[model samples]
Target: MQQAPRPRFGIMTAPMQVGYHDVLRVWREADAIREIEHAWLFDHLMPIGGDPGGPAYEGWTMLSALAAQTQRLRVGLLVTSNRFRPPAMLAKIAATVDVVSGGRLDFGIGAGSRPSHPLARREYEAHGLPFHDAAHAVGSLAEACTVIRRLWTETEPFDFDGKYVQLTGAFCNPKPVQRPYPPILIGGRSASVLRVAAEHADVWNIPGGDLDDVVSRSALLDRYCAEIGRDPASITRSIHLPVSYDQPGVTRDAIAEAIDAGFQHLVLGLAAPYPAGVARWVTDEFIAPSTWN
Candidate 1:
């Protein structure tokens, strides 16, 4: 019998529903599970789906805190919105976390947008950043990527006069512990954003959807990669899936479909406050016996 291909597995917390302690506990559980390889946090000022006035941990602060608490497991934002923080500061923070964690941060980024994803918009506007339209958002994000990459690897400060982001005498100290910097995972489904991911990202994350939906987007990404003379295989493929332990079959089907479609990583999007029993069951029962070996 031909064995199924098993991809890497990950978990992402409910950014809106959980407290700091609950989030840390989720990480602790993930650390204990050898089958789970990565853990992620949503980078938003407030809950993605809840009240804009609710409590939600900041992505970078939680990243640093998680790094300090856990011994294993890669950590990152489902993606830090380029609109929320400037590229240089995000780079500095990522580097610092990498240094503190002995290099275990995944630098996930995205061009922030969404009608329901108003939390990111609110964060930006509150901070005085005008919420840019999709095209403009991606334009600034594309430049932000260049800015971030150069700052991470460049030893000397240099001027970055990007149309949207401008900086002078900027340099990152305590360079990332991961050589060439931590894995960069760019997330989104837009043409402009996909192009940016192809040109620079080490991994490209497609938002969760049905098998056909994700596969189509991945194919488009491959096309984008090819147009630029880069092999599509050069970029790793991943998806953020909504996992409902109540329906084990749904979770199973999602994983199978994703693997069939060439995605090599899966991050379970758990409900807020860490459904501990359901999570542990999903990993140990459904996930472990899948033969990721």
Candidate 2:
């Protein structure tokens, strides 16, 4: 049997549920947890499926604040939308945050807004920005990802040739504090998005999927990695999903299944408001007996 990878926990919380004060408290609590390696927040202008008009803090802005406040945890968005910023600029933002955190930052990215989701369409309408089709958005994401990677590592500036964005003498500086650069995570389900992950991600997040589903998708990613002539093991496997932590056995089983499938980073969508001290609750009920620690 293969030795299981070391596990790292992350709380991928939707912080807008409560006020900003509670949001800060939740992060502090998460930071205090043992083995809690990352602190992630949803990168959305508003909630997707739920209330579209609810209060939501912008992802990158919240990240800058979190970086200064937390000492040990790596701060990042669960996945930032490519449409939000040009690739080079996004890289700069990430690098700056990494510096603020003293090298504690994980850069998670994804193709832009969803076309099918009603709220997404509404957001574009309200904000006066064009909501391009999914194909266009993914293409843009790929291009931006390329620019970000090149900017982070290169000392000299270079031109960016892309359909959506063009950069002459592109450069992002104070290169991320993490050597070689911060871990880049690409998250999504579509093939185009997966291909982008293969091309430029250090970590690929498999969000909202079942165990069997995760296996086949990971196999697909392996195929993508192979197609690119890149080793499949180069990318770290990660996931975040809603689970009924109320049923301790079920929660433990689900986590075990994910670990067996080679997911080293586990970010749970534990219901916000963290209901009765989530950290202590899980540490006692699941984390201890689950063999992750």
Candidate 3:
């Protein structure tokens, strides 16, 4: 019997670094949206592995921009960190973005990690919070998810009391276009993260991990889902692959490997050095193929 067609193929926009603006332009011009299922950008306050003074675009703002510029590609934060913004506000912003894109928004989030910039520390310090503790981070992440779900699904003002956040009579207008809400994609490799994905996330993104890693982690996720009485198949499994277009058609092999490992989605992370080149390759090599059929 023929298997159901999998909704595969996604690309992750490198966060604003030294050359991201140029890359963004290339991607926009290439019109890669015609081929890819989704376009994602990382949510971070500062650039990773770059000069501290280098550029870094806000994830949500970039997503909104992509929503306006691209016609067919679904755009979202690869995963925004929950510690950076209140869940209620995040839900409103996601709803607004969803409405703007005519329902092409995928809401992905995670617990915030340490930033490189000293000023970036203000995000946690200003909140009178501590950094570098995984347990606290997971707790914040769980609470944030609860608040976001409540804000999206609850019609009346909702109240949430949690360890990290407390909300009273929180209401957001213009619910997301996706039935109950936009699909939620959560990221992290920890046990807490897996449990959260099983409980709430519609999709779980494994960043830069191998097939064996995914298989092991997936088992844990499935166990958590079973414990919660939720079907593991209900959650889409995705992986972030470091990809380079320099070798023509390199992604095809990677995609095949990912699919073999039961990954339903691929988040391709373009290689550096002329970042725009990756977008061009995707347009000419992937998008032009009429693969979706």
In model 3, the runs with Cα more than 4 Å from the true position are: 2-4, 18-23, 27-33, 114-132, 247-251, 272-277, 283-293
Candidates in order: C-alpha RMSD to true structure: 2.2, 1.9, 3.3
Stretches off by above 4 angstroms in model 2 are: 243-245
Residue 62 lDDT in model 1?
Answer: 83
Please rank every candidate by lDDT, starting with the best.
1, 2, 3
- Measured by lDDT, the strongest candidate is 1
Model 3 agreement with the true structure over 95-151: per-residue lDDT tens digits? 989988889898999876745556557546655656756777788888888888888
Candidates ranked by TM-score: 1, 2, 3
lDDT against the true structure, per candidate, is 0.83, 0.80, 0.76
User: Candidate 2 lDDT, tens digit per residue, 1-293?
Assistant: 97666777777777665566666777787788866678788777766755566777888888889778888888888888887776788899889999999998889999866777776567656766677788889989888877887888999989977898899998887898888888899988778888988988999997755678888888899999999899999988998866576677877777878887888888877666667577667666655665634
Measured against the true structure, the TM-scores of the candidates, in listed sequence, are 0.93, 0.93, 0.87
Off by over 4 Å in 1: 1-6, 115-120, 277-279
lDDT tens readout by residue for model 1, 85-111? 788898898899998888999999998
